[model samples]
Target: MVGRADDAVWRPYEDGGSLGWMGTQGGTIARDEDFGGLARLTYELDDSRSFHALSCSVTGWLLYHRFFDNAAAASAAFEEMKPALEALLTQLPEGGPSVPGNARLGGPILAAFTVRYG
Candidate 1:
């Protein structure tokens, strides 16, 4: 899962990685709850919920980037779910990244998303 998440971020394809193919796997949850994970903001700002924005950004990236792979399918998925996530992002307030106690993990991890599409 960590590798998959990393691939989704860095997209180090030369290293045998991918941003992964995001599609409706199966079941309602996959489309609903499971995919919800993709939209959960991976960041936080002093308990302010950066993860919500991160989720929207990542899901949007997946929807837009992978559209060519299956245009109709991708569009359908995006239509079924992009609005609410977008609304969540709009509601989020910006703040400085919350630092944790440990030096290594002190900085924000999922506070923001870096997306790439080819």
Candidate 2:
């Protein structure tokens, strides 16, 4: 699915936000009224060399928190990203395009962690 999305140039963050655009595609800015007031967005590099950049970034934060006695906060952060993670899991399965990283398991872990800790 991720490969298909990549092929189709599917972008989760068409609008400028906390999330950065990935892959070979050019960057674009979009607006979501629902998130307009609450979110502050910043972008550095538009394309991510690794296919699982977002997943790795979030997981890296979680891991850091886990090692820093901030697991609770990390769990909370995962809760916020749970929806997209789950969606990614549902959209991609084993041997699927999104199997680029630990996303296959990360998605389920995010979902379970959200339910358990959130």
Candidate 3:
């Protein structure tokens, strides 16, 4: 898991990306793709933990969305994961993340959210 700025020595990795390479020891932190010192961390975590996470940086906040598979599998995962995810994020007193109910596209999308840590 990525910690605060003073937690590790961060360095650039990919294009517009920064990573605090820990070499599997633990805790590899990454910043956003802006190439600025204040970039948000991009973490590829929780691969073996039953779900895959897709993340993006928007307006300085990192957003995460999850899924298991398509069709029936996605439905199943959403049902099982929704409560845990909601409980974890909505615990924030800042009213948690809100769905704007606005998007450019039509059709379906798995729930998307941003986790703002102090």
Task: List candidate 2 stretches off by more than 4 Å.
Answer: 1-68, 90-118
Clashing residue pairs, candidate 3?
A: 30-41, 32-40
Identify the superior model by TM-score, candidate 1 or candidate 3.
Answer: 3
Q: Is candidate 1 or candidate 2 better by TM-score?
A: 1
lDDT, each prediction: 0.29, 0.32, 0.32
Comparing 1 with 2 on lDDT, the higher-scoring candidate is 2
lDDT per residue (tens digit) for residues 32-106 in model 2: 111112112222222232111112122121311111123344344434444544343344444532446756555
Instruction: Report the C-alpha lDDT of model 1 over 7-107, residue by residue, as the tens digit.
Output: 23221222322123232321111222222334432211112221111222433222222222333543454454455444433333332123333223312
20: Cα error in model 2, Å: 36
Ranking of all candidate structures by their TM-score, best first:
3, 1, 2
Worst 10 residues of 1 by lDDT: 44-53
- Write the residue-wise lDDT of candidate 3 on 38-62 in tens digits: 2322433333454333233322223
Model 3: ten consecutive residues of lowest lDDT: 101-110
Cα error, residue 76 of model 3, in Å, equals 0.7
